[model samples]
Target: MSRIEARIEDLGLALPAPMLPPGNFKLVNVYGGLAYISGHPAIDGSTVLVQGVVGRDLTVEEGYEAARLAALSIIASLKHELGDLDRVTSWLRAVGYVQSAPEFHDNAKVVNGFSDLIIEIWGEAGRHARSAPGQGPSPLDVPVIIDAIVAISE
Candidate 1:
């Protein structure tokens, strides 16, 4: 197994199957050693494991886990395209959208779930510039959505 995969195993993280795009867009596209992943819902394909607005029905911790799940979905998409996690050179950036109430502004703390998981698996290389925002809703009203960019070595 790749080092990242091994680390994921150690950390009790398993890559979920990449979600098929609900529309015409592709899940991921790679060119020039960069992979751009589409926004991933926090669903596990069966259903959304978490739902509702942050600070209303869900706590920040709950939102964090949801974001982590979204990140895992992106990782699954990456593995689908690249065949091996070890080929990843670095996490370039991430965009996180949170379905949240207007009063809640802790989107960054929620997105840290994904960042922390990446750091656990990729060490320093996984740290990246990130944008997290409170949004009105997502495809399924899921608590979180995430998209990522990763650089890979050929």
Candidate 2:
């Protein structure tokens, strides 16, 4: 196995089967030595793992898990595009959008789910600039959606 996939196995994690982009947009675009991943919702096939706004139908913790699931899908997308996760040299940036209730304010904490898994698998290489912003709703009404950019071997 490639180093990253082996690390994922060591972490007791598995990448979900990759889902195609719902629209015409490309799932990832590699250019200038960076791979741009599109936003991914917390989905396994057609099933939405968790939906509804945080602080309403879901707790902060649930939102975190949702973000983590979405991150798995993001990793799947990376694998689909790059063929080998080891090609990823560094995580450059990420924007995690949390579907949240009006009173919710822990967007960053929720987004930590996505970052946590990345760091777990890639160690310091996964560290990156991030934005965890609150949103009223997200595509497919998922509790969280995350998009990323990573430096990769060409």
Candidate 3:
């Protein structure tokens, strides 16, 4: 296994299945050289894992963990479609929205979870521009919502 895959194993993580679309769109689409993955809830099975606004009922650290779980969900989606995380070239972009109290403004720290994971997996190539913002509640009332744009090779 590649070092990244080995690390995931060491972390005791196995990417879960990509969620089925709630509407009409595809879960992931590869066009040209980019792969666009749909937004996913931070859920594990029937339970929504994390909830509440950050800086309110949730701490930035807890939000960080929620974001980490969201990243893992994306990896699961990638594995489902590509069969191998090694095919990913770079994590081109990420758009993260954090559910937080109106007074809270530390969205970037929460999203670092996702950012850190990409860097851990693809090294320098995983680094990318990201948008992390405090927003209204996400679907399923999760603490965070994340989506990714990745570049891959066939």
Q: Name the top lDDT candidate.
A: 2
| TM-score ranking of the models | 2, 1, 3
Q: Can you give the TM-score per candidate against the true fold?
A: 0.95, 0.97, 0.91
Top candidate (TM-score): 2
lDDT of 1 by residue, 1-154 (tens): 9888888899887888667778898888898989888888776654667889998999999999998888788888888889998999999999899999999989999999989988878999999999998899677878888888999998
Between candidates 2 and 3, the one scoring higher on TM-score is 2
> Global lDDT for candidate 3?
0.83
- Give the range where candidate 1 is weakest over 10 consecutive residues by summed lDDT: 41-50
Instruction: Look at candidate 3 and tell me the lDDT of residue 138.
Output: 73
Instruction: Report lDDT (Cα) of residue 45, candidate 1.
Output: 55
Give a tens-digit lDDT track for model 2, residues 1-154: 8999999999898888886778899889999999999888887756677878888999989988988899889898889888999999999999998889999999999999999989988999999999998987677888888999999996
Instruction: Name model 1 segments beyond 4 Å from true.
Output: none
TM-score of candidate 2 against the unseen true structure: 0.97
lDDT of 3 at 85: 79
